[model samples]
Target: MTDEFAPTRFSHVKAGENGWRSDGLRDFFLYRDLGVAEATEGKVICHLVKANMAPEKGTGWHRHEAHFQIVIMTKGWARFMYGDQDTLVSAGDCVHQRPGIVHYLYDYSPDMEYLEIVSPADFKTVEMPAPAEVPPFTPWS
Candidate 1:
């Protein structure tokens, strides 16, 4: 019997030529949206999202339909807003999100870098919910 070999899904993504990819912000923001490699149908899909958010530039309110998110702060600080709950996660902190739950981030500092791991990769690719416009710099007050 011969063993079959399967290739790994990912490799390190280098930063842009300028050493930073602008996210239309002054500071710097970049990400790698791992598509189908992390999408495991009928069971769980994982999105290995590594994001570097500029100061005061963060994501909007969005919710998952049949997926859950496990957000981990690997670099700086970020405030995660889930409905009426305000959670501040720094490096080494982890946040879990349930399906149908609305959430977003704000008050991200210049040193903010985080990773979002989504499970059941059931995120809506076409009709993704847009994040609500919340007052910037006031996610956790």
Candidate 2:
């Protein structure tokens, strides 16, 4: 009997192999696909995201419809509001965003970059209302 699910294949994405593209979820950030989704046959997705421009208006309040999601900051820092609490995520920090939790990334440094991993590869993001007031962003000189 053949199994309904196909086996996931191994994947190796060398540095500089795939170019960063601006056609991601946010226009202000660039995304570099790491080939994890393809290798896993849509079971998961891993990608690197970097700032494309200075902070003006950050990502509006939104929630991702995903079973599992995490962000690992690789450089710089960012400010986010998860529910009513404001949290700062910096380099070397990791944040696991619980499924359906309302959050918003309100500010970030110019060099901010992070590795994001999510399940199901193709997740949905729904806009949400702000839970509280967001702090002002630091202006880049």
Candidate 3:
């Protein structure tokens, strides 16, 4: 298995190269792969994630089963509950979410979009209880 990804090659995904698709991550977000998963043979996955639906209810508290994970806010802003701290990640912000840190993305702008990269492409997500009750979402229009 390791031999297959021994020499991870390169990939060039140009603008509008890959179309968006709905996986099982979030019902309101659409993702476009950047060919990192195939290039690295499931070692890493890089993709652009965009909010496609309104923020009626954001992603509930959940933790990813990954060794490394990061989100770089490229457009707009998003409110997230990281552990017990409520953070607003805006454009130009990069967040390195340590593995197993419970978080809830509760609100975001219509143009909210970010680049998310994670290790072990086929990582798992385990739903957990929220650390604290989340406040009402602020209007995002």
Candidate 4:
């Protein structure tokens, strides 16, 4: 195998193996790292995130500074504004967020949960003004 495509170490994580903590992206969403960050040595990071505390205002328009990112909804559903398009992501739905694509997650069900995988364990988020008028946020109970 090429050095760039190195053989990653073995990693086995149970669903409840790790504890959840507040995510840097949003305080209302809790995150649990799946050990991919350490296993890959900052090359990639995988984590499970779920709704913890409902916020009056949801995640506004923002973009992540990374090479790649993807989200797989594990439970419930969420509505997001991807550029000029409004997308509804439900359980089992997977979405690949292109680099630097601005998006706003405006609404979600109470049981919202997802698995996010991104390249580079440490990434940056840039908040930007909405390209279009955002819809009213519906609070999650």
lDDT of each: 0.56, 0.94, 0.91, 0.88
TM-score of each: 0.57, 0.95, 0.93, 0.92
Worst 10 residues of 1 by lDDT: 17-26
What's model 2's TM-score?
A: 0.95
State which candidate, 1 or 2, has the greater lDDT. Answer: 2
TM-score between candidate 1 and the true structure: 0.57
* C-alpha lDDT of candidate 1 relative to the true structure: 0.56
Write one digit per residue (lDDT tens) for candidate 2, span 66-93.
9999999999999999999999999999
The local lDDT score (0 to 100) that residue 30 gets in candidate 3 is: 97
Name the best candidate (by TM-score): 2
Q: List where candidate 4 sits over 4 angstroms from the true fold.
A: none
Query: Between the candidate structures 2 and 3, which one is better when assessed by lDDT?
Result: 2
Clashing pairs in 4: none
Pairs clashing within candidate 3: none
- Two-way TM-score contest, 2 vs 4, winner: 2
- Per-candidate clashes come to 6, 0, 0, 0
Deviation of model 1 at 47, angstroms: 5.6
The CA root-mean-square deviation of candidate 1, after full C-alpha superposition on the true structure, stands at 6.5
Ranking by TM-score: 2, 3, 4, 1
